[model samples]
Target: METIFGLDLPTWWFLVVGGVFTGYAILDGFDLGAGALHLFFKKEESRRIALNAIGPVWDGNEVWLVIGGGALFAGFPVVYATVFSAFYELFMLFLVLLIFRAISIEFRSKEPMAWWRQLWDVSYSVSSIMLALSLGLVLGNIIQGLPIDDQFIYRGTVGDFFNPFSILMAITTLSLFMMHGAIYLVMKTENRLYAKLTVLVKNTTIFFVLMFALSTVYTLLYLPHMVERFKEVPMMFFFPVLTILAVANITRQITKRKYRFAFFSSAFVTAMLMALVAVGLFPNIVLSTIDPQFHIDIHNGSSTDKSLKIMLTFAVIGVPLVGLYTGFVFWTFRGKVKLDETSY
Candidate 1:
């Protein structure tokens, strides 16, 4: 019941968690995207450059995910337990992929054998793509709602996460991250590889735009209530509008061969789109399709007010520290990725 600038503590913590995921999506997203497009770089050196482009930062990028997961468990224990139990299989696969993805990168350069390199490359790319898809599937299932019972328990099986809408979202998310990763790679390469990616960027742009458009139409047609928040708050409509403009800017920057700007625009587009999702799902961390009464909202799902306030205090001090470290690392490694003996 306590308010911070008129918003309650649980709501504030929701924003914190959402913000952490947004950071994760933008940071780890590029690396995952880079890995998705990894196999496309045919030449060995090309692949190394691509890997090294993300090498300094991929693991660090995952730090946000760790933080986000912790925040979810801390702030919404019930929702976390229900969703995890329901999506157990996918989560298990996701965990395996995460481990493999890291090992793939680490072991790819351990041996110079063609078979060794090929094996790890396959593992890395597959894990990255699957990781991105898994994330999208989870979000899509959340948006579409689960069969949560009155006790805030998920009454569905693991297979339920694979519903058609979730599949569409997985593909769309892959395309989006592919494009995002390609842009980041472009920023970190030059000469022949850069030329190839100039073309790749254009193609990925078209791919993402097509998939995104199709997803939008499908959501509007079948999942129209996603627009409910926008309808309720006319001002909220501008979020999508700005996202559109940012999308346009992506093409414009890519065409101008200004990849850094294009990368920024792509990152912005991600943040804005995620903001839309956060807005659409505000208050309800997990929706219940069977009955609204069974929904796990911020109020019902959150820790006690005293707990939230204490968590918020740590979050207030902790988030900016994470943000600062993230910025410092990126700045330290800024500019084109140069290969060396240590490169992977």
Candidate 2:
């Protein structure tokens, strides 16, 4: 791979993939979060409003996931191949839930029957929560290190993915998404539903903070190597500082009833957290629990420089266009949701 200012093309591709994933978390996160909180809205109108809140852009937001996955595969086929082979069942489950979530929204309002709506509502919320948990579980396992051999094959059973720290992270991810969704709902609702979401935002914020704190403590106490870079470079402290500031801004904006600012802060928090993860796991695409030398990183895992360069060209052009489309969708639907015959 070509090098730019000491960093190779593979490393640059890694950053691009990470950035794309961060975009996914920030965009689709509120979509999942809103679904996760579906049961909280008991009234029929409240649920519809919540569903419609994400109706315009949910599918578009998921494009980032596709792009991120593609970038990973194109840039580092080894990581993609190894991860997919290892997490086949988990990914299958994710796909099932993903389908359920979509239908739950479209089918919910199709029939006026109570049981029918109830079924879809439950499906939507449960599927959303499961999706969030799955993402967190994958992240936790990646951070904790995986049981991969020198041949880049996973040795551990699927059951081993659910360690204590990973489980906690799954919960933390759920809480974070809940908080993000609540903040979004607060922006897209009014009257009783808006008022209810106001309270939810506060509580979810607290929940996320508590969970994040506990996860941090666990990582610090048990997974010392995770923070090795932080200790080695005093300047790496900025990421944590940025996270704290962004979280504090979330609270500040929420307290002031500035939904837009609060929403941006929530996005910022996601970006900062994901950035830290990327920085912490730099070079190493997947950490090896069995042996350090078995670790999969950019150099050993990446495609040829020719392929990376071509993909980089596509990415450079594609990312901004997607961003523009997303921004345009948000701009089009930039207000509290009102139920019309057209609304889902």
Q: Cα RMSD to native, each candidate?
A: 1.0, 0.9
The digit string of per-residue lDDT tens for model 2 on 1-344 reads 46877988998999899999999999999999999999999999899999999999999999999999999999999999999988889999999999999899889989999999999999999999999999999999988999999999999999999899999999999998999999998999999998999999999999999998999899889987778888788899999999999999999999999988999999999999898888788768899999999999988999999999899999999999999999999999998898999998
Candidate 2 displacement at residue 71 in angstroms: 0.7
Error of 1 at 194 (Å): 0.4
> Per-candidate TM vs. native?
0.98, 0.98
Which regions in candidate 2 have their CA more than 4 angstroms from the true location? none
lDDT of 1: 0.91
lDDT winner among the candidates?
A: 2
Residue range with the least summed lDDT across 10 consecutive positions in model 1? 152-161
Clashing pairs in 1: none
